[model samples]
Target: MRLHAASLYYFDAVRRAGSIRAAARRLNVASSAVNRQILKLEDEIGAVLFERVPGGVRLTAAGEALARHVVVVLQDFERARGEIEGLKGARIGHVDIVTIEGLTRTFLPEALGQLHDRAPRITVSATTQGSDRIAAMVTGGQADMGIGFDIQRQPDLRQAAVARFRLGLVAAPGHPLAGRPWVTLNDCIGHRLILPDASLSIHRILRPLLADLPPGEGAFVTSSSVQLMYRMTLAGLGISFQTRLGLEPELARGELVHVPLMRQGEPMWSELGIYVRAGRSLAPSVDLTLRLMADHLVAVAREG
Candidate 1:
């Protein structure tokens, strides 16, 4: 006998609720109505569906078997519903977003704000990790999309440039290097320096110059929070290196100054971009987020 979808739904609801009265409460129906459906389903299937107990109902062996199948059917139906609703332009869904800690504070919020305004029902769950971690999370399927500077393309992922940025030398106000027209990397060596970890592309490019600096002089090496590091520099911790976008507010406030460094001429400077898995299918909401991300990048570049 073919089981009805309503019968399966009511059966699962009763099993979860533990009693016909509770099931009725959950389904917004009368207790008698719930009992009638369960009884009708048992008669049609020719098996006892539940065992009566002192306080409530318990599923019989057959009922337990049917419950497992009912759950799968219900879950599959819900998945299909979500897929269809997405195509219908329903904004109700979730997107897992990963990005570097620095961009999350400055660039991402500006972009995400616009995304939420345009698609209020679509929710973005964002997590801030280091650049390498962000790349790993996206490639590993832990996140749907990512926003990072100097994105690395893994075999399983594809990257599209969303914006371009370059790492620059920044010093706190009243610091010795603040008024320089431009300084070579060697010139920066004498002063205390705060640097990004050598593992990142920016730092890797700066490594030769950084290594040439006088021994025991490079003061800081870390990743993933330029804002905090910049603050530390303002506190006179050291001269920090950061992306121009990250230093915008500080530069505007005159709390920090950008001192140009020798351009190595290699594309060590590259565009910040969006990355998605190459072969994996993306949800419509995620695709929309990527599109918005591109637009935001263009706007950011233009404004600068």
Candidate 2:
């Protein structure tokens, strides 16, 4: 069962726990033992792995490279275990996932619940990032899977599932635009806009629309924080521009409303993608969880 070296485990533990002492505590071993293992690991590799820091340790460039390899090696071993145990109806493994921020609010919770219910021992770590970083994490083998928007097609990434939604305006019910069936940029003029910042891909679509607005009507709150944009709009400060993906509960409660934003008389559309590294054979547990999450998002996206 001991396929990888013991030092790799200690290194991975320290990397995750951020310090030798914390890693030792987690592993129920002595801090000196953990430190000795890490020292030997670095000596073997002929490179410094962790930079001693005030609160915790940080990875050096070489550590980052080795950490990625260690994670892949450990995870593949877990996959092999899961694949064998799956025949006995005892699936267990860990899956690391990265996704775009939008789906975390709505789709992730329900999807994760389904995954847990079906594969009770399968542990998952899900983190949110913008589209580009999500793709990079999956492609680099830092994550087992990724869900993102408009990810660039690359030979190393395999598209697993897809969902397309219309980008629209989100508003408090009392706002002027909330009563509209649909809106155009000209129609949205004079209304203060709470917009996603350039870090998010949606901003690219919004930038050109904002440009067509009258010069003096440019008073808008632009932020990298999605929560800030949502809260600002919910407080009736201004309308936010985004997909209806995460606003279902607010809209259902009558606290907010969404109207399709039109461009050249057509609805502005956004696409969400589910991806995994190409040529990687996922464990039954990881594959099942990915499919569960993808199916949930795809079904939600298809809803009118």
Please tell me which predicted candidate would have the highest lDDT against the true structure. 2
Alpha-carbon lDDT of model 2: 0.85
> For model 2, how does the per-residue alpha-carbon lDDT over 115-134 read when each residue is reduced to its tens digit?
88888888888888877677
As for candidate 1, its clashing pairs are 162-273
**How well is each residue in 129-169 modelled by candidate 1, as lDDT tens digits?**
76667677675455778777776667877885576665567
Please list the residue runs of candidate 2 whose C-alpha ends up more than 4 Å from where it truly belongs after superposition: 14-31, 51-61, 212-216
Clashes of each: 1, 0
RMSD of 2: 2.7
Q: Model 2, residue 72: displacement in angstroms?
A: 2.9
Candidate models: Cα lDDT each: 0.73, 0.85
Worst 10-residue lDDT window for candidate 2 reads 132-141
Worst 10 residues of 1 by lDDT: 261-270
